[model samples]
Target: MIEASLPALNRRRFLWGAGAGAVTAAALLPGAARADGHAETVGAVMDGMVRDHNFQGVVALGRGGRIRTARAVGMAQIAQGIPMRTDTPLGIASISKRLTAVAVMRLVEQGALSLDARITTWLPDYRADVGARLTLRRLLSNSSGAPNPFRAAVAAEPALLQPPWIDTGEAVRRFATGDLVFEPGARFDYVLSNWILVLAIIETVTGQPYREAMRALVLDPLRMRHTTPVAPSEAMSYRTVSPPVEWINPRPPFLAAAGGYYSTAADLLRFAHGVYDTDFLSPTSRTALTTVEVASDSYALGGRMRTVAIGGAEVRAAWETGNTNGYRSVLGHRLDGRGAVVILNNNAISQRTMDAFAEALLRADAGVA
Candidate 1:
């Protein structure tokens, strides 16, 4: 069900940190006098979501390098009665694409890979004609024109969802080799094959597995200790809230880079600080990572650059969302480094709803009515 919209505020009245009226109102709210109102506002929205949408997961709000709200509601594993916790790792789905993009940019910064170079430079074993035509930038921006065979194959045969585990190179050779659906870089065509080929390139350039390279390049440095490419055994997803029926989503190992990592809301907030608030990435790489490569999709290298209305002010933010199986997540942070909202849920929720909830949280955090 779609949530009712939050009360509208004047865009010109409330700037991020400069609004006197907002600060005074935040100081007047009960239990928000000491805090930045992030805790109070985020908690209220989360409580409503849990009651209305059966949201079962963790949420963390961050500002000025500190976590203001980190809360978990409902159950992580309903059958076992395992309650959700702020640290509980849940599948982040396509948000992994953002992480993968960061890893690729790190390589670019190190001179290990070039965005404009043909993918064949690293993946010589790939199909000559196709690889020669594709580049790292095209693949990262989802304009490679590579077709997604897994989606069709899984739809036709559900059993294929649990395909045998294959190494990155073998998986790329088998599934990523295909005729271009459109001219490379002419337009955006978001498909899993682009990320699959990206993983192969990372492997070739780094001489390490995708998971290890990512841990070294992004996760470890960001102190995201709870994040992992491998899904946890105890984490169970749900399709509905009324009856709480289980939804078993199988993720083959080869597709980890595309959408198969488990993370906590706190860890994701940590990622936001590292990527947006710190100098973890070089200036050149950071600019490329956030620059919108496709205007139609608002897609940059790994995530989307979005302009959202917050407290009447037009705010540019880095927005990344993931929805696969019964899991859904959102990581939205302002480009100005004022604040961020991270929501991770195991019970299936529509991406549109999740995006709205995240935005509402951001608005409330800023003390906009």
Candidate 2:
């Protein structure tokens, strides 16, 4: 859902100062600036985003289980005048998939499930004949033929584009009747429907909602106090709470496994630390999280496995991105967690800015020109 009324953004200004180069890493302290004077380059770019664009959020960098820099910029709500802080909660869209994946994997680690098992083994009534033929890995890897549930939800509930909210059950019920776009595992097509089905399976197996399972398996143990599956009662940003004209508020079931998780910069850093430390999954499981099982170049079980180079530095980057209506986010870490960046914006801001910031961090980590 998108508000058609908001003024068109200044594309040039939105991306000003963000370019591909060997800029300083935000993970470094201010004093850590290189003698060549590129160390504080990240801070300058972040400062520019706030001072120039209407960017509002926090940016945190963590390495080796230590938070090197965690700073907030702009206001949480432009009208209410609330300042963004480390603990300021933000809707981290599809990034939520990683959390959901981790929860499901925990069940797998417990011998409660297998990634390759057919969905029919768990939910016999799951619609799509192709789904019965699909395995959990295919779903996680975006190879499942499921179409995005959101598209179907919007088409069915035409009023969903506006504010207020809708019931979660309606979304689920509507989805239960849909069919897959193709036979499972035959090809990779990124679809939110894959995760919604995953959530259904989790509920069928655990006898609890997907949110409850995640809180139990991932959030609690990691002490991610600021992270949860709870939907907000009000808009957290100055931006319109929901899409305009349609005026539909965010509702549960609609959020399911595809989206609907929330967290703060502080909490996300903690999650990064936990993953690097293997606090939630075993060493083998941790390896699986980063290991590339598929060749899509954008997704994995619970995170995205990709690579990017900044200057002369080339590193394997595991990441996930999410957006819903007014939210946009990027969360990913380097292989060693030596460099990780979490950027969340309320509106459809430029992801290129986030990517440029990440490139800068990789440059600093590699200590290259």
TM-score, every prediction? 0.88, 0.79
RMSD to the true structure for each prediction, in A, is 7.5, 7.2
Local distance difference test, per candidate?
A: 0.79, 0.64
lDDT of 2 by residue, 1-369 (tens): 111222343221222112221112343454544433443455555555555555656666666545565556544554454555555678887887887777777888998878888877887766547556778888777777766667766788766645454443444455533666777656777676677678877887888766777788888988887776665433364344223221222645545577777787667767777875556688867776776556665556756776777565577777777767667778777775567777877755666666666566556544543
- In terms of TM-score, the best-performing candidate is 1
What's the lDDT for residue 51 in model 1? 59
Candidate 1 stretches with Cα past 4 Å from truth are 1-32, 36-39, 155-160
Q: Candidate 1 residues 1-369, lDDT tens each?
A: 112332231111111112111122243333735464545565577667765665667776777545665666667777776766666789899999999999998888899999999988998878899888999899999998987787776678665556667677767866788888899988988788998899988888899988899999999999899899777766788897447798887877778888989987767888887887788898888899889999999999878888889877899999999999899999999989988988888888889999988988888778774
* TM-score for candidate 1, residues paired by index: 0.88
lDDT of 2 at 249: 28
Residue 69, model 2: Cα distance from true site in angstroms: 0.8
Q: Model 1: how far is 284 from its true place, Å?
A: 0.8
The local lDDT score (0 to 100) that residue 348 gets in candidate 2 is 53
